[model samples]
Target: MRAVRFEGVGRIAVQELEKPAPGSGDLVVRVEASGICGTDRHILRGEFSSRPPVTLGHEFSGIVEAIGPGVTRFKVGHRVTGDPNIACGLCPSCRAGHVNLCESLEAIGVTRDGGLAEYVLVPEKQALSLPADLPPLYGAFCEPLACSIHGVDIAGLRPGMSAIVLGGGVIGMLVVQLARLAGATRTVMITRQAAKRQLAEQLGATASADPSAGDAVFDICGPGGLLSGGADVVFECAGVPDTVALAPKLARRGGAAVILGVLRPQDRVEIAPLELLLREVRLLTSFLNPFTHARAADLIATGAIDVAPLVTRQIGLEEAPGVISEPPPAGEIRAIVVP
Candidate 1:
């Protein structure tokens, strides 16, 4: 099997490797579609923590080729999406039902062999069933949507409330749809890309803005602005320092600012504690998906969320390394690798 391996920092390539077999309580998934994520680029640049010399794809879905002993829930030929984050059940956080914050978290593609290859191993518990008739490419979106679900949950959006989503990337785009579904009446997307802004509006954003404009933020949140007195909730999905810093400022007094973006580990941003204090804004952060993968699969299967527009490119495993090596092109969302 050919796999895209993260050799080390600044190094990644397609390497031929032996196909894997399922272990006890595991299943072997024949890679059908894997999405190239910003995290993949961060891992390649050594900005994100990962185990090198391992396959580098976490957002993927495939057909079950084989099942190991103790795996009774699924059978071969089932279409499934794998939840990459594996948490130790005995950990303190897990015991408290905070599995995503497990003391020791191991992730597929990051710390283990993942679905970037012709075959990848997935534990039965981490796999969620997808509709057999669903598009192979759509299954890859379950992972990211699950993560976005967590972000929305943290935001606590309510009916008729307004939301501001920073960055028009895949996460932002998905959040826009989820916000509308969550009953947010006014949803705005802010990004520098004109194409992504247009797409966001089509997906569900009530409006979109170019953050590069000097008065963009003020124009939307200022008195008598688009969203006068700011939004009820602000989501920072760009994973950039500027957006991180902008999140709280965009939230209305007593509203919440949820950081759904994953910035480089060493990255830091300055925030005005006094302003947040005076406004009583709740600054919160959302991590990986926890107990949300199944809901995401159901949403995708039912066509409740539009994922077809999110897929910006499709390439073979051979091209996976190159796509992750370079920054995403303008207006690009997700690039799926069809193995």
Candidate 2:
């Protein structure tokens, strides 16, 4: 089997490795499609925390080649999406139903062999079945979409409300659709790229804005602006300091700002405490998909969320390392790796 291994910081390559077999309570999935994520680049650049000497793909889906003993839920030949995050059920957070915050977390791709190879082992608990007829490439999006679902869930969006989504990447685009489904009547997607702005509008954003053109905060939240007095909910999906700092400011008084972006570990941003205090704003952060993977799978299987537009490119497993080594191409949303 060929696998993309992250040897260490600033190092990643495709190497031939032995194929894996399912262990007890696990399933051996033949890799079909895997999506290259920003976190993969972060891992290569030492911007994100990951255990080296491991395969580096988390957002993937495949056909079940084999099943281990006691794996009764999934059978051979089933198409499934794996929830890469493995939480210790005994942990305090896990006991409290906050598995994403488990103290002992082992994520596939980040901590162990993942779906970047010809085959990867997935614990039975982490495997969620997708429709047999679902496109293989679309199944790869279930992981990221699940995470976005968790973010939208935390935002508590309501009908007839307004939402502002920062960034126009895959996460932002998916968030836009989810926000609309969550009943956000007025959804605004802010990004500098003209193409992405147009894409956002197509993906349920009521309007789009270019933050680089003018004062983004004022143009979107000022009096007589799009939302006039700011949006009821704001989502920071750019994973940058600027967007993180601007998220709360874009929220209306008594509104909520949800941070769904994944920032570098050492990065920091300054905020105005007095302003947040005066406005009584709620600043919240959503981590990994805690309990939303199933819903994400259902949404993708039923064509409830449009994911076709988000897949901008597709590459072979041989090209996976190079794609991860370099930054995404201009205006690229997602690059799927077909193994």
- The alpha-carbon lDDT assigned to residue 122 of candidate 1 equals 97
- RMSD, model 1, all Cα superposed? 0.8
RMSD after Cα superposition, model 2: 0.9
RMSD of each: 0.8, 0.9
Candidate 1: clashing pairs of residues: none
Query: For model 2, how does the per-residue alpha-carbon lDDT over 1-339 read when each residue is reduced to its tens digit?
Result: 999999999999999998887789999999899999999999989888888899999999999999998999998999999999999999899999999999999999998988888899999999999989888999999889999999988988889999999999999999999998988899999999999999999989999998888686567788889899899999999999999998999999999999999999888999999999999999999999998999999999999999999989989989999999988888999999998
Please give each candidate's TM-score.
0.99, 0.98
Which regions of candidate 1 deviate over 4 angstroms? none
Tens-place lDDT per residue, model 1, 132-162, is 9999999999999999999999888889999
Best by lDDT: 1
Model 2: lowest-lDDT 10 consecutive positions: 212-221
Q: Quick one: how many clashes does candidate 2 have?
A: 0
Q: Can you give the lDDT of residue 18 in candidate 2?
A: 89
